[model samples]
Target: MSRMDHRNNRRKTWISRVSQYVDSSAGRISLTIALISIIGLYLYGREIRNKIAGVPTPSVVFRDKKRRRVLIIGGGYAGLLLAKALHHKLRDAPVHIEVLEARDKFYHNVASCRAVTEPGFGKQLWIPYDRFPVFVRRNCQVTDVHTNYVVTATNEEIPFDYLVLATGSINSIPSKFPITTASSQAVATLGRIQRSVAEAQHILIIGGGAAGCEIAGDIVDRYPSKRITIVEALATLLPGRAVTDEMRKVVTEKLARRAVEIVTGARVLLEDEEFELSGAGFPEPRRRVLFTDSGMALDSDLQIVCSGNLHYNGHCLQKLAHTHPTILDEHTHEVCVRKTLQLYDPMLPHIFAIGDVANCITSKTIVACEIQAKVAVQNLLVLLNAEFESGVGRDDLPARLKALVQVEPLQEFGVPGPLLFITLGRSDGAAQLPFLGVLGGWFMRRLKSQDGMTASWWRQLGYDNVLSNT
Candidate 1:
């Protein structure tokens, strides 16, 4: 036979054998399973690569020169939700949404406590901003905010037709990641903290608030034999929170069951230098002494302070304070906004603030931030649509002011009442709901403690591929 004819006959014989195998139900099922496994692996590998190298930002397309710009200053929970909501609401409209965040990745502060105790878990806590629906300009720290524009640390001026400040706040390490923290840096920081937690025989956690309680819970869950002490200035645990006495009791009992020590009505009296050095990390001898205002001295191998030393990220609005004196609260130092979430300035109605930076009478939790974001998005759309209907140019200040609609505030929007969820560890937690009152560990675990709600957050932010593994 000719070489070509011989090759063709060989191919036909192989095909006939494959057809014989495929004729069986088991062969078809096996082939389908193999195909599915191959596709699943490809998708998972793609997600891992994206997580490592980071996803590239989509190119901005300004189809119209008259397109309005909506600038959101923080990439926290509120800013990201607002950006996504605005993008979806204005998908067909002539508007552009942009988020300017100092950090390269969105740090999931809710999961920070767990990440500090559990190694390798930090990788899921810092998600890249590129996964969001809107454009995010990471590592852009705003220095000043004017009537029409904002100045970044690099002195680059970015003008927006409407501005939303959601810079959130800064907390101590492990509870909150620092500004400009990249994903790798955040993971490394968590790893270091985990090592410190694992090595320490006795851990001292100041402040018996939710953070301190959760930290102790996480540490105890990881190292059941380690000695953990929580010191609080308040008389009871979870002071200053909107939680009920029952909720506090539940949390306290859970921690007590874990053999965690609690000291209340006493404040740690450490100097700034000493407090910093203590919290920095494990030092030589790995032994430190802390004194409280009650003349009590406590010794521990490691210290973690959750004393609620939070500072709002509204310093960029300082320049505007000269003109709009009420732009920031005199005491809280947070941005002062009207019920409509707008900067309480008639001349600057186009500027709005939300999240922890806004002087809202709500808990500084992710739920409050998301609710405020929705309200801000609604009001912003009202103004945007009104301007479009009024046939006024974007630069026409007087006409734009006249075109503005009477926006509704958060109260008028039927905002959900205050809800508090405190997770002790992966399987234990407590929550104070609106009508449900206070709940125990089962509800808390199902609601938040199981996975820190990280999976839900990833899915909410448009990352289903990451959700599969999470």
Candidate 2:
């Protein structure tokens, strides 16, 4: 072999070694960087998810705008829906809406009826308002009404441009036991109610509305040992509800089978520790001396007065009503102009009202409120188009679903609650429907029929976001 060939071979060997070293080194560096980037990305994503999911997004963002401001009072189904709608619609818009609620959490009154009657159901009713972004103010009951300003129980004044009065209606009886506070006392009281059913030998449920009837059914469902009686002043149970005849028969029979007694047209008057009833036989509202209309007045270990849902005055509602319901009255039965939801005065044009505080009415559902909030956010951006000739417009506006809402004389869901799921110790379930019509279910025997509440407001508060298992 020649010297030239040998030299070439030696050079080739050196180049091959260098290439192998470079390739391995590059592979290690690249793998290390990739692993680090993956770890960093995972951590960042986790933190973002936790914060974003802590509560529904605050308000909204607008386009072609500096910033939009909104204020909502109450975190009810209606109020929360409004906030969510605004965020979804105006994410790109310059909108910032704030919800002012009296409590730190949102308690759904709908589910309370069943929870109180049935065991292991109350905790599902409360969802803290802090889970969402609206600035939550707890223990601040609204007081004193005025134009553009809201005075709270604490005397601190909050100013707004547009006002909403989503405070809704105030009911008396159970309203006194609002689950919103989640006070230890309340939990204890609820426990006591359950215990009363377990220990008491006899129960007297006054009134025949959903509460009175359901309480009887639910008690029977829980403790069949208790003798339950329902005293209704009305001619029939669920006078104007939408229930079917078959359902009514089934309910009545079930209660009768359980030896449950019901007496219609019985007016109870309390004189001392005893209750007297006035019936039809005697001309002057004949009073029962010791026995009841059903001829069985035993000492009751528990007496539940589930008769009326009263309308106590609300300061925020009064002020909002004095200021803007008049404006909304003219725009009645339709969605309020988007910017009109701004916490500003409608007459002034820059101010708006949202949630229940505003007079924008259409069957006060959370979905409706959410839609109004979204529209308000989009419109705020449109109004904000001062620098440019063209204003911001809706790209993907949320479609408003027609909700079933009736407010003539302010009747709440006049339909009879589900009988199979009735809460009244069951001899007293009532159902009234439009066409299918006129029914009642007596679950006085089962007591544990339907544990699911129909209108749980906690869902609107986004409780399902975290408590999926519940």
Candidate with maximal TM-score: 1
**Model 1, 294: alpha-carbon shift in Å?**
2.0
lDDT of 2 by residue, 344-367 (tens): 333434444454444443433333
Tell me the tens digit of each residue's lDDT in model 1 across 185-300. Answer: 76877787788888899999988888898888888987899999999999999886566788788889989998999999999986746456314232332588879887899999
Candidate 1 scores a C-alpha RMSD against the true structure in Å of 15.2
Q: lDDT per model, in order?
A: 0.78, 0.48
TM-score of each: 0.81, 0.56
- Candidate 1's C-alpha runs over 4 A off are 1-65, 272-285, 402-416, 465-470
Candidate 2 TM-score, C-alpha based: 0.56
